[model samples]
Target: MSKLPGNAGVTVLGDKSVEFYRDPVSFYGQRMDRHRGRVFLSRILNRPTVFVCSVRGARELLCEKSNIFQKDPTDLMTNMYGDTIVTTNGEEASLLRLSFSSLFTGNSLESTKGYVTRICEQHLKDLSSRGQCSYSVYKSLGTQLVLGLFLNVNPDEQPELYQEISCLCTQHWHGLISAPVNVKVPMWSSGFSTALEAREKLMAIIKDKLQNDKHGLVGTLGSLPLPDSSSASQHLLLFISALIPKALASLLTSFTLALSGNQQVETRRKAQTDADYLGFVLLEVQRLWPPFIGGRRIASQDCTIAGFHVPKDYGAVYISHAVHRDPEVFEDPDSFRPERWGERNAGQQHLLCSFGNGPRSCIGVKLTDAFLKEACMYLLQHYDWCVDPSTQALQYKWLPVSRPANSPTISFSRLDENPPGHSGS
Candidate 1:
């Protein structure tokens, strides 16, 4: 079969790279009408890649034929996390997921709801204390809450470990992932060595915590009744490294969207009705600005997406930006309209690929949703926040996690701080 149309070389890849870096928020929509269902072949960071921008393709790759598909992290990623669930596929991944399944549902989910509220409230209080919080600050607060809820890290009480791990995971990943290539460069030696050492130290802290008790619903494996064939410490490391970036990005995106939306605090408090406007806001944000623009998966045996022939072990990257922007699926797909989600239930909701579709869909969804709801509720219910009117529209960097490249400033005022019947922000 003829190769799918795309920028596999500088000839085709050049424009996409430039635009993605230059303007992320509006870039996808600008090209969506022209590129939907098109597979663009390109080399990213010198690696050959295929970006399938179709919902059907993503569903098949991530779900329908997931049996043959597998998780494939970079060589650098393999070094940091050996065989944790995030790195493994097939039975190994299942066991790791099973070991942690107890924490995903039932009593565990019910118990963690309180922590969600408390963490959001505390973080907002901290944000308010620093009146001029930027986009980066929101991400930091989200990361802190992720740790507090999952691993039980008390950042205030243990600043060293908290700050150290954050540095290693968030700031130092590029150095760590490039260790092999940088080993021969004299100037890169310090960063290369530091990455390895930091990983070890961070793992030690995580192991100690998991062996003791789970911070949120991630209870110790030993305490659970299910059979666990995985190392809880390594699993914790996998999740900690994997989840932190997405956690930060999602918070930034959701917060940015909420501040931009018309929904009010009083409007959100009355939940469980047909018109839960805030929930719609969250879904629409994910649809328009997913934390992860793309995800990688390997072809199991063989498959065809939109007439594309993908052989076994062939690498594929599904671009969510393409999938979510399908005009056939989403009307006025480029615009932010939260009300579209009001009537969507579990059945037709599959049309949205914000979390991907099928077996390999993101596991962090439930927790992510919880955190978003908690954060949104806390912000809207207790404060009036606004994006600086002078700042440019939401533009982001996709790598690591999708966040505003410029780090724009946002202001928040507690409800009580305002005069009675004060309306506009």
Candidate 2:
């Protein structure tokens, strides 16, 4: 611990255990300045950890795919999603990604088009009915779309399934982020117990679906020729976490923010069907608001990152907030400009680490890309968006993933009604 680059004994933000609990990005951003943008040390919930901000350093730590940087037991992915692709290392993670590879074929995606279209229409219709949308609406849309796409639930059962999912996601978040420090002492927590109960209930639904030969990711998992028997366990881990919820939040936030300003998207309002433009907008949103901010890796043995020694078993944090805002890579590091992502900036697109990058990039990247593109096309071809300036621009709440801190008031009216302030494609 003493060998790390910054002053080992000092606390950042001038507090013994500085409170960045609600705002880790700011904490790391300040530390990045203090350490000259490479690396620094801080304690998350009072646990000693290393914070690495440089793009090259993050890439080295995340992309290496070696035993030297492994998943720590404390990582939320490992804690909440044991041994899944996000939480595993090297060959095992590689193989898990490979097994899911078949799920992304052109033919497979094409088959999903009609369903995706229907889900989007229904979700949009719901938004229109509500007149204004916020975090709950977005989350509900994601959960509904997920259940609608993944399962063949009867119309009567859809509400119940959504309720179950909501409970599970709520409890999962509670367990993942808000439990007590001494809660490891067993008697200190009922939250963990509640989360476990919710998990059992959710898993029961999954097991029942599997027994009845259901569809979507559950069926895809076993049929994909996974490399190990633990594939069931790994698949179970990944599904229990809210993949759709995070993506849903990202999609809504990005699209609304894109429409609220950005002349590039305005040009495409109705005249252009350039697939490239839609992709670029989504990419820009993610670059600004990555679904998950950076990630955690544990050193398996002694290893050096950008000349600083990372000792064995030490936890390393890679902050996306810092990496995404690199001035060298992005022109006006903090502005919301989608035009900056067009053809002229193609060379740096690879630098966008929204869904992560390199060998073990997000397992859901292809599925998510297909989903986002389809959603973007639906929005561009359908309704225009308007932000309620009475409401603020997107502010964040950093959980295991980033989500809107509050339900900002945003209107998504239909093309026909065309409210004066609203703009449509």
**Per-model lDDT:** 0.62, 0.65
lDDT of 2 by residue, 1-425 (tens): 23565644434443333455657777776777776756776555344567777777777777763457776656555555557767777787778777766656666656766777777677666566666766566566566555655554433466666676667867765666645332334555567656666666666766666557546655665577766665564466465456666666666665665565335345546323777766777777787778777777777888777667777766677777778887777789787666787645675777766667677566656767777776666666766656665457567766556766765776665667876654532
Q: On residues 107-190, what C-alpha lDDT tens digit does candidate 1 reach at each position?
A: 766777887787667767755456656656666766676666667776887788778778767533555434354353555565
Task: Give the Cα error of residue 144 in candidate 1, in Å.
Answer: 2.4
Q: Tell me how far the alpha carbon of residue 72 in candidate 1 is from the true structure, in angstroms, after superposition.
A: 2.1
lDDT of 2 at 106: 63
* lDDT, candidate 2, at 254: 57
